[model samples]
Target: MARNQLLNITIWTALLAPVVYIGVMIVRIQNGEWDLLGPEPGRAVTQFLGTWALNSLLLTLTLSPLKRSPLSINLISYRRRMGLFAFTYMLLHLLAYMTMMLGWQWQDLNDEVVKRPYMVVGVFALLLTIPLAITSTRNWQRRLGRRWKKLHYSVYLVAALSMVHILLQVRSSWTEFVVYSSVLSLLLIERLLNRQKTA
Candidate 1:
């Protein structure tokens, strides 16, 4: 296979690992494993999906730097898949929160959005992703031309919003949030340096 083709194959194959993981999670949920029940059960799934979304976002951001590195393999093409996967996980996370936590009750949903600050941040992040996700296509890129780049830069804001949401959720535990934020900070610094170098 051509090099990029082989890379794509590998990318897709690697995605299946998440499928298996989610399947196992579902089995555990059904089996009442992890002491997940009632409110906790829904929260367990939602948190799991949300965690993947955060990781996916980080991975998507990381790919740009890797593409510029001296590594033999280029990962640019795989970024689209990673971005889409991130959005998928985000959507699922929201759905789980809505269904499991709120039980699809509109009144409760409204209250959650209004009363819970983290929920507001999460919803805002998801909303911001919609435009980026919609314009991810080559057709949209061609259609938007230079404007496409300006629009996509919102990913940084999305990342910030995601971090805020997570931080709000994990107020006491700084380890995971600190690590992801540090990596994101590095990515931002690298991007700035690269832009300056190119200029």
Candidate 2:
């Protein structure tokens, strides 16, 4: 197959895999294969979604640095699509938390934002991701140029806030905290190294 075809296949697989996994989980729960009403269901969902979001974000951040290596240009083509997928999953994660846990109550949002520092950070991160997602379009990229880059740099902030969000939520889970912190460190290091090389 051609390089473009291979790249297309990879991008499609990356985008669809999470949907398929989440769909299967939902189907299993509906079929009584797994109980969604368990004591830890909410925590389970939160951790799962949060972890997936972080992983996708890391993959998105890796694209440019990887491209600067001897890797093929086709690899870089996956960046935008992956970034959009990251945002899609992040939005789903936020919506699921709000609808399933908070019952879509605006008052509950107000309370959470004020009472919970982690929730506040998560909400802020979600807000930051909005413009990046909106401007992920080719047309917007062409129109905005340099400004688009400055806007998308907010992804780093989003990633930092997201880590803090997860860290605070998983209070006692030191293992998870370590794992996520390590990954975020590596991603940031890759970004720094790439910048130094370009400079």
Candidate 3:
């Protein structure tokens, strides 16, 4: 198979998996199964989205390191697409929190963003994603040249902020945060090692 075709399949699969999961959750809610797994619908939905956001972010960060493995070179071509999908999930996460939890109330939105540190961090992460997602396009990559990479480096900041966001929200659940932190650490270490080798 062509590299692009494989990349397309990977991208679609990654993107669709989350959509399917969310659809199933919605169906369960409609069927009155949501309460069976949680104390409240709002909490369950928020938890799902928050977990998905962090997972997608970790997946994006893993792509580069995984590409270094001989068996995983196919992932390199799809890294940009995967990163964009991560941003998409982050956006959905934000939308879910706003629509489900805050109910689109302007005052609630203002108070949450101003009073909640985690919410602020989440918003910052989302904003950081914009440049990376926008530059993922081939045309933008060509137009930006060397600047393209410098701009996309924002992903690291996005990842860090995302970690902070999740950690603050979970407060007690260190398991997910630990897993993501370990992955980020390994990816960063691999990047540094590669830089040293090239230098």
Q: Give the alpha carbon lDDT tens digit for every residue of 1-199 in model 1.
A: 6976887787777655675677687788777675644457777778888988988888899887888878844677778889988899899999888877888889677767767789989889999999999999999999999999999989999999998987887857799889889988999999999999999
Q: Order the candidate numbers by TM-score, best to worst.
A: 1, 3, 2
Per-model TM-score, in order, reads 0.89, 0.85, 0.88
Q: Pick the candidate with the highest TM-score.
A: 1
Flag regions of model 1 displaced more than 4 Å. 2-6, 31-39
After the best TM-score superposition of candidate 3, give how far the Cα of residue 39 lies from its true spot, in angstroms. 2.1
* Steric overlap count per candidate: 0, 0, 0
User: Per-residue CA lDDT of candidate 3, range 60-141, in tens?
Assistant: 7777777777766546666776777678777888887787788889877777777778988888889988888877988998
C-alpha lDDT score of every prediction, in listed order: 0.85, 0.79, 0.79
Off by over 4 Å in 2: 1-3, 31-38, 70-74
Task: Identify the superior model by TM-score, candidate 1 or candidate 2.
Answer: 1
Off by over 4 Å in 3: 2-11, 34-37, 70-72
Cα RMSD (Å) between model 1 and the true structure? 2.4
Give me the overall lDDT of model 1.
Answer: 0.85
